[model samples]
Target: MKNYFKFKVLPYLLYLLINFLYFTNKKVFHHPKLKDDEAFIFVAWHGDLVSQPLNYFNKRPNGTVKTMISQSKDGEIITKVYSLFGIGAIRGSSSKGATKALISTIKEIKSGSDVAISPDGPRGPRHSFAGGVISIAQKSGAKIVILSSKPTKYWQFNSWDRFVLPKPFGRVDFYMSEPLDVTNLEFEEARDFVRNKMLLNIVS
Candidate 1:
């Protein structure tokens, strides 16, 4: 059944797949030391979700980070995959259950959980930054960090964002921007700031 596959079969298979890819890949971080006490809202591109679960957990073993994924079928599958890595996803998006999602995310951040979201996510214009991602940081008092990466060897899908999957034993170079305070930024200003950061790091 479709439900069975989404809830059981898919998660198991994807878990194995990601684990193999992640465990085999060499990750190099380019950012400064990140403190555990500070909650941060990290923004990344959706395509990079391929190794995100392990990326976050491996960086901070407590698995304190969570993400906002859509309610679409792909989102369902990804949510399960995230669970397998001890990561969590808060389902829903700007077009659906936007309010509830915003509230829940704020609570998580306030509770000292680092949260990540793809500003260009769910469905995308691919790497476009939207203003909605800023409000959570403003309201929760969490600073924003732009999460980006470059892999020495990888496969790029022909999907909208050209999703990436790092080949086994490849090297991944990751870049995390300094925590940015968006508390007083206008919506447009915040969006531009995020967009510019992506341009600088080029999350591919």
Candidate 2:
């Protein structure tokens, strides 16, 4: 029983503490250029996920957002953390069963929920965007919004995506760029545009 608590419950408690510091201590600036009723796709760099949830759900505290995770042990841990924060996770990735994950994400958006995604997640080369996120934007008729966060102090994990943990009581800044529309573009063109736009938002 002690081992069970140590291995399972402890990690979740730590995750909750991290989120507490992130949401309570940060000064978030939201520039919502999009309409409230409009559904949208969200793309963020993996490092920016340290405070992603705080930015997406500010207006509607109970709003639903979906994200993708790989079907691995780490993914399982992340899924639990997201669930605790009221986030929905679809377990798949670009290298794995991406089609099913994309289908789930699209369905969520079509159902009037915003879909938050990390285009360069689940073992990314870091900051390189993929095509699937844009495809969802085109199919769902939703504008794509890029979200990012930069904390004044944090830990960067030495992983493929450089997972971040904002230090306790540190100030974090969230940048939500103006939404991108892909209403009347070809698949390839829309994908390229969204990818480039996200990359620009990350650095700018």
TM-score winner:
1
What lDDT tens digits, residue by residue, belong to model 2 across residues 72-110? 776777787787778888889888889998899889888
Off by over 4 Å in 1: none
10 residues in a row with least lDDT, candidate 1: 51-60
Q: List TM-scores for all candidates, in order.
A: 0.91, 0.86
lDDT of 1 by residue, 1-204 (tens): 989987779889978987787678788877756787898898888778775665565567774888898888878888888877777788878767788999999999978888889888877888877666888988887888877777888889999887888888988877778888888888788778877877675545
CA deviation > 4 Å runs, candidate 2? 1-7, 200-204
lDDT score, residue 14, model 1? 79
